[model samples]
Target: MVSIAQGTFRTVLLTPEGRLLDCRASSVLLPSHDGMIGILRNHAPMLCELQKGIIQVKNIPDRKNAYYLIDGGFARISLNHLTILAYEVITFEGMDREQAERTAALAKESVATKGSFVSNFDEEIDPDRAAFIVKLAHLSEIGND
Candidate 1:
């Protein structure tokens, strides 16, 4: 039988803009087109299309857990490395408290009043994604203050 060992692997998140994250994570949860896919060390190599949802990276050294909201793209897992290429990614990673709060508030207002979120004037608004943004903001503790 094939064996899966317990260990850490390199995880990277990228977008058309640039690379957003590179770290060692014990586990990762990806939003696949069909459903959620969990990854650990020594996983079988594969590639899959992604959907609009959150990517959770867990157990990184010297840092708390991380989360990224992706619009849609693809993911590749091979040689103990997980790389995600998304069309768009949103997170509070580098935002200051003020910016985070403002983003959180805007997301909340958009969901409550407009029933959808629009990131760009040309882009279509998605109510479901807006709701997910609110959840992401809450998880980031953006409005807990």
Candidate 2:
């Protein structure tokens, strides 16, 4: 694929807790409500509601791609500046990938356990939701894709 691949822009990532990262990136792949959406410099102005997935910031100078797992959020891209406002953000920076993978495995195992699904008057934990979360956790740590 031959992209004009021209230009760099600022990407600001913020959560309700605080700002996570602000840096220049050649492109950013977001976890939109529909699916992953990629933005590059000089892209059109747009806004998207996010979902459970990973945010990928690419082509950062002197660094590998940065990944963040977002629970839900809204993203805006305009005039070469991209901003992410997330309800929750779990960054992979300095994370122990092995531990994360193991934890996700345990979560999957628990979900698969026969008759292990639980519910309360206030909230119910369904097997399908548990499985989806486990999948997202696994993908967040994988970080390579």
Model 2, position 49, has a per-residue lDDT of: 96
Each prediction's number of clashing residue pairs: 0, 0
Evaluated with TM-score, which candidate comes out highest?
1
49-101 per-residue lDDT for model 2 (tens digits): 99877788889988777877677889998888899999655554665777555
Candidates in order, TM-scores: namely 0.87, 0.70
- Which 10-residue window in model 2 sums to the lowest lDDT? 114-123
How well does candidate 1 score on lDDT at residue 138?
82
Q: What is the lDDT of residue 111 in candidate 2?
A: 88
